[model samples]
Target: MSWHPQYRSSKFRHVYGKAASKEKCYDCVPITRSVHDNQFCAVNPHFIAVVTECAGGGAFLVIPIHQTGKLDPHYPKICGHKGNVLDIKWNPFNDFVIASCSEDATVKVWDIPKHLLTRNITTAKKELLGHVRRVGLIEWHPTANNILFSSGYDYKIMVWNLDSNEPVISKPVKILDAHKDVVLSMSFNTDGSLLATACKDRKIRLIDPRSGEVLQEASYKSHRVNKVLFLGNVKKLFSTGTSRWNNRQIALWDQNDLSVPLLEEDLDGSSGLLFPFYDSDTCMLYVVGKGDGNIRYYEISSEKPYLNYLMEYRSHLPQKGIGVMPKRGLEVSACEIFRFYKLIPTKSLIEPISMIVPRRSESYQEDIYPLTTGAQPALTAQEWLNGVNKGPLLVSLRPDSRKQLKVEKKLPKKENMCLSNGFDVFECPPPKTENELLQMFYRQQEEIRRLRELVNQRDVQIKQLELKLRNLCMNTGSY
Candidate 1:
């Protein structure tokens, strides 16, 4: 009944032989929010952010992934949320911005310092208040910049546009009330047309973002669903959680009609929650479990059963949390596609795992290469604020961009303790004073407001042209 026996995995090697330093003291806090929900450490091209709990309580630590060191004594991480921070998400379009939801019932957006090498840089850009109970989830729209969706213990999902031009008290554009229980996780479709939410009630609901309507609903009576995600470009979905017998399970179902899963398989029971990272271009789903020393991936295709077991990559140590770098951040020259930053808090180390395809010939393999979603925002911050939503642009990695990587023999132990492949690591300058950062933050907000006004003007002109056309048609019909 489970695919564990049938699973096969490709080889994965450690990218950085040494672990990235953890700034905080190691504590035995589990990564799961509840019995089923798994928390993800947020990552971008520039930095990785993790919520840590020490003797002093919780602090949101944002560290440069490229650099390794102890916590800067003066700049002790950003401590905005009064209660435990449950989840954090990096803005897909803006590398310098991140959103964190906490048990304090608040979602705060922080502006990351451009230069991380300095000390004492903590700037809270905006604190969002709407949920009545602990807020657990905050996700940025895939295509829309600054448009964020958040859900909490109060069983309400709120849509927000982070344009600081408006008053702090009136930022939530829409408050959706449907879930009878806590909303566990949510995913937006490729085109941003539909939002699928998984609730603690063991039901998945497909929602109309514009109308706040529940278009369809599916139930899994077996057990509570932990995570639900939309399959790339396909009208299908995947969910992972527990079964009635308290076994871990993964299921694939049709989005239009989730009456029954196309495929459902049980797995070995473990307390660690499995967080899935999907690559739309490759149609591969990588499942990384907290407290597990391995990653299991499966390839999805347009066929019966839909999912084909690929392979698992094993390691020596378990992870407290994990963050995945975007596809655009991979080193294309090394035939690398995915890179995972594994957090080992016990050792105060962060390790990188690189998944690469082996090549022998000096030519690009057309079959294995596909265009990936670009990080660029589909619309400017102003356009997103003006109710414009669109899919992201795709960047093609073809011909010259793809190169054959020479396969090397596996190294033994500490002998291979060196950074592999050539990757560019940009250094951030020293941190700026709080006064200087506040001035820059306000200036950026003003610029976004002016851009919004220009977009509004264009909308008026477009409406006028439509009105004239309608009048001309009416006159001709009357004649």
Candidate 2:
């Protein structure tokens, strides 16, 4: 019998339903001859936001996937951008708050009404203006609430604090002006310390957002880079772009040095851009190309050539846009790890595709559970501005049923063994008395306390020595 039954795709419903109709389509008439990997669709824990380019402009549709037709007679279809809506991202912390960018050259933050299923139209809660050209990218701070990052064709990356209650000009808190060409894509490391960007000038740059300095920069003369991403907890990067001869390629690089890529592979030339999505818990990277019908995934590990091609999922209908659901939104009961929403422009529908692990047991298996990526924010925006580098907030997604489903097993040392004399012998020693175990625990705790004190003393001495060296260098008139 199969060990895992819940992981099969045939068990779960694949098509959630079309989000828009012929009368409500976002981009009824194509304005441009191309569709870029804009990350146009975004899904939060509850709702999914999709950008459809309209003839005159574009519209943002906020539809409840579970309640698209049943709960609400009409879902909220937001029209705020004067031009095409380039991208939309839901706030990680707030389900109702969404940030969108447009060709109108502005980023608007919208706060959806409480009764989102019934609400038809929603307006912007705040408007941020700084980019002189079309704003195409927007990313919220993973850990810090009310903070956002945006990039535009003007070659500027602006960091804004959305906590401000003022209606005046929304001045950015910090601006990064390093890229000479248009920023094609921008992504933050898991902790939000480093910001990686791919530009049209064939360069990939890592910037320190807090200090506004280029931490590391590398350029490739081949083709225009499309995306730069940081995966898992490793100090490495992945980039997708075309080579000099117009051959598509995906390469892995070391974060410290970009003199040469660690691993590189060539793909068939296609007009659609490749969008990468990494799952830190499972160390899997899903690569989906815009306007393509297949999703290719690779399992990344610490071994050489980190990316190991896993498998691919193909559909008859090519996707115009794709949105991945957050980990928490996945169906854990079905042993599902990732869920994707693929937008079929021809049908004017957003179909759901789930990736599940096939398992047989009815129990919740702890061994096969996925670790959620970006579980917690490392530092608050205010703290980061204050020059603090608090590490990530680690969280656990262990369900309560896990403990109940676990079966206690004897350790190898404690199990019975067969002796040479053909007699069974217990390998484990008899259980120690309560007081004896307590004594051992106390001794271990004492050693831990001693080690901690030594560390503290060493830190204090190191600080004092640094101060003395600074004073000595100043007195000697040397740098």
Candidate 3:
């Protein structure tokens, strides 16, 4: 039987010190990796990024979705950071830009390659640095591409403009002393106007990104808000983490008035910390940490949340361990696990047979028109109708050199339309799991070798029996 991954647990006590639990944890460890709770999104389904503590001090792991289960020595290494990589976030608009914060007290923006960045960004591309202490958080502006924010133990937050030659030479557009202690976490409101910050001081502060104004501040005097989860609605936020201050409480807060939580609930009898991949869509959150390695799920809703307790499951990781990752599907716990497992490279893994990168066509234009059904809206109505008969796309350069906007307009009345047999690039062959395929090939070779050895042994035995029968016949004739 194949070993399962479900048996992995935090400690002997985590399985309630039962023999059955120990066996279960053992069955699951080899195949399973850690997972976070999210109503939607598979666990590490597709690794956008990874922050790890490895032999080299710290490492950033990037998994190219196209390279799924293959193991290669070189993947993506943005380089430049001098210490352990602590966090990573993909540029919300341009999936091309990735931001990673490090213990080196710097947050560097990397250009994620569609295929691979054979060259590290630091070798030739400019590097951006601003914080004086270990950077703790790096968040992209919810609304714009050029804007992003960084915070660290420096007791200050700095914002950056990715477009400039001097990313940080430009004074931080805004600065705020967000907390009395190290700012453990910071996040912006969904609209990009407000920023919520959590700190070692047990206080959560909301700031105006444009003006660096602290509009409201609240203290979980009963406990500390280790992380502040902002509801896009702006006036409200949900928080989870250790209650060094509520016995580790989970609370909902109205940022408009941060004096008191709208609602608060103590964790189950067990002391646990709130750490998870929070989902804005469903308003549910995952909490993990403290004494247990299991993840807890909760739904937060309300001017103040009532903190309805949800399901909990074991996520194997070291104590005081930490992880927060993307959620792209409903309970993608396994997906997350797959990506996590891919982070730690193994010996003798199969390397993917990759295709050569395609170069842009010689005739490719910098301002290529978009493909729409029927016509280019930029053309006159009659021209649009004519273009519809020709094809669905029209390339235009007349608008402006800098802003060549190519708009798509739908064709009307398909009464005489004829379908075209254009080939589909999307119909590429389905992929095979690199690991599973390699195992099958290895097993087949072993089976063939074993069969040949068995055949040789049978031949020798038959020869011995014939010789013995001949000896018996000779002895009878002598008698």
Candidate 4:
């Protein structure tokens, strides 16, 4: 074959990372100082949520995606957790819903308002209290709605089905007690049929989430695995950890047979933990170290030499954490294959880095932009819990196709739904006659008058309290 090619010739071989301008980045964010290896940031198309440092309780700031640049110091936050917030994940199916786990040994689900937040939200839509110790990890089921998995310091994994309207789930649907030590990381297979966990005990276990059974377990003597991920399409498991020599290493394994890795590569002897993020559509793997300013990426294939090094993107500021935007949220116009929100703790900034595939054509690149997982769930929580297995719904990335999908998503159904905390937004028929309109106006006027009276009463009470405080201070000679 003409002496065989020295390197693989692929369209993504020249992919490059582009950091967004300072004007487009989020600044002055008080990122959390927790020593946990969790990503401190989570992003969706609608908003970017970042865990922040707070007193008394844990809090996270939710900023509208379009409202970039310097954030307000007094911006509203979700501050319901009694302990430090460890991890937060947005529901794959619902953009307005998010679940957060904290050191308080509880997991809370919050319903975010569609509009910008104007006040602190101290209450969660639902609270889960099954963990006996601090919860470190929480993940939403990939293809199912209302299914959540949490791993705590108690070395137990709890699966919750949030199909019902209950505000609290004190009991989980299933509890997996396989790990003897703290769980370091977890990942679910393609249809979410199998769960893989890397634990502090130096073992990786494949578990059946529905039945709470351990399907497979393997531990390499030379590797201390810290993070794990499933290459859904390739039927492979990937991990990052340290070798016996304390050098960082990455391993790839067959999901069914983890006795030996298909490939193992040793990286530098950096102390920072490597966080691995893989894009199923593009077959790309991005490895970002916690305290490093460079992102090394590779192309994963099913053939020999499973991991092929592509390129590395370097920066001056190291990233404390990172959040990945979904494939659907990428800019197809810019040929952006992936986007990452890099959290810079020293500068208190969140920067968006877009990985672009340079193509001259302005037209949509159909080969690169394949039909990816859409914003719909393939199975309901009940269906999944009942042993149903299905892949995620896929949608096109073409402009016209995306517009059509958006239109279809906006079409309202017949059922009137109520969110948590009895928050209801009802669609009512308009007044049919002038008399009805007049009656509605009169009712509103009466309510306004009553509110004004309540305000006046509160004002008088405040004045009386001020007078009493002044007199008391004078009596004590403290004024």
Candidate 5:
């Protein structure tokens, strides 16, 4: 087709039906995107969110993959925040209600539904003034839907009780200094017990949300922290950093002992986490890497405290930056991602939804593709040599099962023998069809016949050359 998947023909049912009806609730936290959730929600693999221009100017926007359904009658101008919108998020309980933060120091709540965005009501949810600089992030409480948190360049993290549109405690509940330096990132744990913040101070300080007291701190000098996440099951935290260190680092901080990392693994050469979210149901952490041009899904378990580098998905967007949302429900692993580009204050977010669904990413496509050592799941040293399906990596010469390498001691040299794992080892299993063996025989004979015919042709050509040589000799002798 001449058009991209965004313009190509597709159906919503085809997309939604692909998600299995499995629903598991992940702890509410920020994430870049979740494929496990996308699969459940039925989002198309290439349907990543962009401040992207659709075929419709701004009137109505297509949801990426399946061609023509418009999200709203018209996009809401959302013009209250006097400056650029640094963050935008939807309320978990209410899909129509969205909240956006701006350098103008105002967080405006826009109640807009997909079908009718006409109720474009812009209410100044809360105007936090203490942060002399721009607000960096705004996150809602995982369980307490109305409670919100905003962290900023002023190095302070504020907790607000957005209990009502006009509240008694509309002011900051806690304005605690999150770091010794500028606080770059901050988020609440799944349980709301701890808040993990990644700072320019090169540290991840765990603070109690209620009192705004520093509960624990995990410091590292290898690289400055960009984003820190409190992983699923409430036992560990995941973090991402820059090029000075392994661009993507999964530091599993034991909840019991927050000082040292139980498992600190690098994402090979992958750039720092563009955004990351944890799937409470699958215990998977999906990370979107910065300009590295791929979205990676990693599985982190508190029980094991080790990150299983799962898969890497290629994105069709030319986005320089992005924000992600975790799979709200459980039927799948796909997460929602919004890709856009801009600079300066540098604040964007991947939010959370209460509903559960599969994730959307290229990995869900029905085709096989190559993977790097990091993208491939880690196999035990024995599994790689054993021809097990940790993943399809072993090379086999046999047509049926993969062949195993066997070392044989010959008279003078060692002979390397490749053995069949299952398919051709001993007596063949029952054939699928009655003519299967006959079909194989015919195929073999056809190959052999073709080879023999080529040999015979060569022989005839040799004979003809001999006759020509003999005639030439006779002619010379006669001369």
Candidate 6:
């Protein structure tokens, strides 16, 4: 007789989800009514930005993370897009910077003020115009600073370098034009060396962003992938889609070989699209479906039966969209390893759900809270564009480490106010006199001019390097 183990013993087996109280949630939010299947909210340790409905143009509200509860009806917004906003993402390196794409076929990068907002912001720090159709997806490079990727209905992906001090970038550094249909989802590998994408053409592609070359492609008649995610630290790719019989399904594939999936499992008969989020530190994957109230999580392993079902977090109110907080934003003292901000449009509220590992002791759990990707970038934009690949900087989540982070985030005494608990809690003092306000405006103008001059110099150097490279290729007959 053959013996087989039915269940695996693990510490995370008892992990459960807990929702925040009503007063802790954000209420009375005018969530966008657009039917796009994208997450309508973007969050970081500092702020929560949600796409809202507007009459004349597109706009999104940026609320301070700590200011939870009911919001005023006329709260300030960041309104500039001439069309409906499709997606928004916070820069991984800089919490004060964010990028948004819209049906206007433009991508705009905005810099939130160091202090809380008082009026609507109608200007963007930088505007990128490249796509000929409505842009739907935007993602920042995981390890590089000032690098962003965006895809649109044109079936092309544009890689932009925001490092340039220029106010507008008319041309992108590189373009990946391999997809024949709209790209559904994109994920980058651990070192940011490769990109995996799922498209509406029923194909999965692995591409080298540096050279605009497709490294590998796979398609299965049984699966129609809607979302793709890279399992960092593990050389595998996971995707969620639908099976031929209209059942939701998930599959795991080896990063190197895409001929066949390592495992494929059918979920249910739900028609809504599934969004997958992975936590590399805990090796946990959360799958949330659109128009559903349940969040299913699983543990991933490199051994046999690679994907193990952990449990599900069920709720009565369905989520219109969801935002995930970075690992640094989690509360280590409470044994919280992950958090989800669910957008409940029906109630006009955003609720916080904390995923905690059951523990009785008050001390920190070092085993569960391992070193995670920090808020620092590993490389600069120019280095990444020049064929450099690096992983994100890792930081310890110990209480002492968090205190040090808080100290580093301190602002100048003259411009500082205080928050009771949040890491970034500094306020800028209002200008007392008209003379002081004038002086501040002139200083900003001067800084902008200086940056423009620096950008011009950098552009000249880049052009010189391109000329030299072309000449070298011509001499070697490789052009």
TM-score (all chains, Cα) for each model:
0.74, 0.74, 0.57, 0.84, 0.53, 0.84
Residue 106 local lDDT, model 4: 99
Q: How would you encode candidate 3's per-residue C-alpha lDDT over 1-479 as one tens digit per residue?
A: 99867532211111111111221111111111223111111112223354433444445555543344433455445556777666666654444457776777777776655455565445313345667778767776655545667777788888776666764443655577656678777776655557788887888888876667788878766766777777653357778755543366677777678888787777755554555445453344556554454555655556322455555555343233333333221112111110111121122211111111123343322222222111112222233222221212223322132123211233333443323544321322122454334333443554475568678988999999888888988989852
CA lDDT, every model vs. true structure: 0.71, 0.72, 0.49, 0.89, 0.47, 0.89
Lowest-scoring 10 consecutive residues by lDDT in candidate 2?
9-18
Assess candidate 2 and give its TM-score to the true structure.
0.74
**Can you write out model 1's per-residue Cα lDDT over 412-449, one digit (the tens) per residue?**
44434433542211211122455345434543554475
Model 5, which residues run further than 4 Å from truth?
1-74, 113-115, 118-130, 164-170, 243-247, 268-273, 303-305, 316-318, 321-479
lDDT of 2 by residue, 44-97 (tens): 655778775445666777775444333222334787778888889988766677
Error of 5 at 379 (Å): 43
lDDT of 6 by residue, 255-295 (tens): 88998999999998988888999999999999998888889
Ranking by TM-score: 4, 6, 2, 1, 3, 5
Question: What are the clash counts of all predictions, listed in order?
Answer: 5, 10, 23, 0, 46, 1
Q: What lDDT does candidate 1 reach at residue 468?
A: 92
Q: Which model is ahead, 2 or 6, in terms of lDDT? A: 6
Better of 2 and 6 by TM-score: 6
CA error at residue 4 for candidate 3, angstroms: 42
Displacement of residue 72 (Cα, Å) in model 2 is 9.1
